[model samples]
Target: MTMLILFELPQVMMMMMRMGMLMMMTTTMMMRRMLLLLLLLLLSLLLLIMSQ
Candidate 1:
């Protein structure tokens, strides 16, 4: 029982780490997309102002 518990502990920690990494990656990707969209909006606004 003790050995089984010890073996499972590392697996659980590894699973948690993987989950955390996935969440971080997903958030980073979303932020990058948002930044890109904001940049595009700014560029369009600048173009409009320049045209006027």
Candidate 2:
């Protein structure tokens, strides 16, 4: 049983690492989209102010 667990431990660790990487990728994508939206909003506001 000890040997079995030792073999499984590496697989579990690898799975956890993969999950973490995926989560980080998703969060970064969301942050990039939010930044783009904010930039667009700022640009539109500036344009409106200039037009006024």
Query: Each prediction's TM-score against the native?
Result: 0.90, 0.98
lDDT of each: 1.00, 1.00
lDDT (Cα, tens digit) per residue for candidate 2, span 1-52: 9999999999999999999999999999999999999999999999999999
Write one digit per residue (lDDT tens) for candidate 1, span 1-52.
9999999999999999999999999999999999999999999999999999
Badly placed stretches (over 4 Å) of model 2 are none
Q: Worst 10-residue stretch by lDDT in candidate 2?
A: 1-10
Candidate 1: worst-modelled 10 consecutive residues by lDDT:
2-11
State model 1's lDDT: 1.00
lDDT of 2 at 2: 100
Candidate 1: TM-score? 0.90
